[model samples]
Target: MESSMKKPAPDQHDFHFWTDEKFRIADTDLNGHINNNAVGQFYEAGRGEIISSVLGPPAKRSIGAALARVQIDYLAEAHYPGMARIGSRIARLGTSSITIAQAIFVEGRCIGMAESVIVFLDKATRKPTPMPDAVRDGFTLLG
Candidate 1:
């Protein structure tokens, strides 16, 4: 369990991520609002985008030895074909993984929050890998 994040605040350094997304017509379930699964998908995409920007795409056949425990909180409702903007930040860093916190907003309205615990993994053994230098630098708060 080795962590790469030195600082707790990702915003202190103006480190922020914004991605434009629109709800698909198929996202709506019988309830009308976005489906339960959709929320998690949106959050994952946002978080993945942040990491991918630095590491390119994760090695599919060889992902870093890491497992993610994801938790999502829904605050408001979203409609299909609606626009959503996701913001990502780092909340905490443990010995082996980092906890990233993300929020989904539509036209400035807070709809939900998603948190994920991502571990750095070794491609060879699928075991937790020591934080790499490049990843460590990428996760560094902007400041």
Candidate 2:
């Protein structure tokens, strides 16, 4: 559980960014295709970038916080030695948590998509905390 809350369905409009990632040899699996885990990793990169931008610093654990949920959908296949472009957007921003949606595209086609809900918490008590103003400011929609 990520504290008490409700989350609406995620939509296309939730995406707000794009990131480019180069595939490495280790990123491939025995099948000679990019591992499924790579897709989620790219999504996480995008989320970290956005969170850092909003917080005026690099993204971290935010004291006692941690990733709460991750839902991924694989659409197509990704080959090795290719480029992965990741796109991201905020779907939900709650009092103590935020939901982000991300998509992985290779060779101009979507290969995967993921949604993650991350929570903020008090470092000492490990309880949910209000999203700091600095962090919320990065979400233009809420302004």
Candidate 3:
């Protein structure tokens, strides 16, 4: 699929939360490039980090969060034996969900960009739940 990120390239300064990921040899495909699945994992790690930092750990929260949807655009191929810098930021917030904007950079170049939606759920019923005031306020600071 084509992504609008093709032109003007993504800038790291647009993101607030950053996660450092190592591109392992095992993450490479037969073509000697890092696979798409591996790139997704990097995005997951970045999302987890930003969530934990903003809302605290999962074990202590009354509400849980789950990834509802994700759209990633492969802008360039990434190779192994390199470091991936994943950048994440809250793009939009809803009553029960948050939309995250992300970009993956390898060797200082943007390789991919993604947007993910995460829904808040009640821990007991597992149904969609409204975000707490404190939680909303916390994430607002980051955005």
Give all candidates' CA lDDT scores: 0.71, 0.74, 0.92
* Poorest stretch of ten by lDDT in candidate 3: 1-10
- Looking at model 2, residue 21 earns an lDDT score of 94
Question: Which residue pairs show collisions in model 3?
Answer: none
Please report the candidate that would top TM-score against the real structure.
Answer: 3
TM-score, structure 1 vs. true = 0.81
The residue-level lDDT of candidate 1 at 51 comes to: 67
User: Which prediction has the highest lDDT against the true structure?
Assistant: 3
Q: Is candidate 1 or candidate 3 better by TM-score?
A: 3
Task: Give the distance in Å from residue 25's predicted Cα in candidate 3 to where it truly belongs.
Answer: 0.9
lDDT of 1 at 50: 74
Residues 4-117 of candidate 1: C-alpha lDDT, one tens digit per residue: 753232221232777778899788889898898878778878777876765677755234634478877677799887887888876776655778777788767777777788
Candidate 2 clashes between residue pairs 3 or more apart in a chain or in different chains: 14-89, 15-89, 16-88, 16-89
Order the candidate numbers by TM-score, best to worst.
3, 1, 2
Model 3, 96-140: lDDT tens digits are 999999999987899999999999999999999999999999888
- Per-candidate TM vs. native? 0.81, 0.79, 0.93
Clashes of each: 8, 4, 0
Candidate 2: tens digits of C-alpha lDDT, residues 41-114: 88888777766656545335454456899988777788878898887877788988888778777876777888
